[model samples]
Target: MMQRLRILTSHAAVNLMAAACFSALAALAVWGPGWVWAFVPLGVGAQMLNEYNLHRFVFHLLPPRAQWAFDLLYRAHYGHHDFPTNEKLFFVPVWVAVPMLLFNFGALWAILAALGVADAVWIAVAIVPVGGVLAFLGYEWFHMTSHLPVRKTRVERYVTTLHNQHHFRDFTKWFHVSPGGAVIDRAMGTAIDRETLKTRQRSEFIRTLGLRPDDPRLVSARRRFATRYGLTEGEIARAAAH
Candidate 1:
């Protein structure tokens, strides 16, 4: 458990979000106490929807034809699917997480203020920096645990099972990693019925996001990020052999 947490906190994105959540909660406690009860739940619910939509729509979008664009998506998500146990790829990258957090908070604040909410800024704080970020941290924790080789609690095991289905069975299903976010997946029609698909067939090209292991794009991406991501020659070769 300690090791898993160490790995979780190692990512810059995790640390930043952790700080944001704490800072926002502290600020809300001092200045916007009344708004906390209402807005925090709103933030959490909003982030749950955001988590499902981003995973289903954005991260799982068709591979880009452009090598550069493909590389970006590979770093953002494809590489995680290709190497499911790679700790480095477990959390959302800081470049992606930080910007999206800013955009969401800014947009919410603007919308509320324009609509004449007197406490728009603090309300956004309560919702985003506090509640939304807390849910994001939950996602990071569960996601990291899903990939780690550790004994898990009952709830953790359940989450890991569903997440494994997404990684190994069908990438298109089970987009929500955070607990309780599965309802969003069910509502959005992405949740697979385990009873209906008893055989649990693995998705084609499961490791490469439906691309051939040796496709030019995968080859280029692996080579391009090899040194940066510490992918040894053997790992690169093995990925291509899949």
Candidate 2:
């Protein structure tokens, strides 16, 4: 179908662009000033931070009502939440991600050039998106495998089940697809406790409160609610609390 071909072409273009960016960065790092390499980590960190913020603030909070905005957001985010295992929807559609990535990298490069760090900026502008693409690819593949009909290996099975648990039970904690694990989520106080997560699977009582799962305020709220209702500490400590 034309739709499938379009999707394939879009995915391919995004990936190719990412690869070209990486190659450019690599070439700059090898031939340019040694100091340029120092900016690599910062570039990676910026992209990661962007990913975190976009997921937290944009995708989760800013629901779209307008037709174009809704379709864009739906493809980039909402569709994933609606059907987490939909292989066709795993990677961010190229139409959405490519232009934004270029604009961001271009802007950052311009700023760095103004600061007399053009070489470093070039490297970063090249490498960061490439690294991001690799991360995106990993997320896409893992997400697809997670929902596949075929049985997974033990570790794969664990991660897939964990991701599914995040979709059906707790959406806050387990935000990272894989490899990244809970590093940023834990730092942001959005991580679900393992034991508490287990408890959430058995009880639907906690899901009634439409609390923002990533918000830290829910922690105190849970404690207060428990005290007010005379609920057991274990019950109050459920992952659904935050």
Best by TM-score: 1
lDDT of 1: 0.87
RMSD of 2: 11.8
> What would the per-residue lDDT of candidate 2 be over residues 1-242, giving only the tens digit for each residue?
35433444456544665576667567776776765556555655555666667667776655444545554555566545543444555666666567767787787777777788656465654446655545554555566667666656776787687677666667655666555555777888877776787666533322322334433443444444444334456554544343
Best by lDDT: 1
lDDT of 1 by residue, 122-221 (tens): 9889888888999999999999998898999988999999898888777888999988978888888888896845655754737887888898999999
Each candidate's TM vs. the true structure?
A: 0.96, 0.65
Return the clash pairs for model 2, or none. none
Q: After superposition, how far is residue 190 of candidate 2 from its true place, in Å?
A: 1.0
> C-alpha displacement of 8 in model 2, angstroms?
8.6
lDDT of each: 0.87, 0.58
For candidate 2, the 10 contiguous residues with the lowest summed lDDT are 202-211
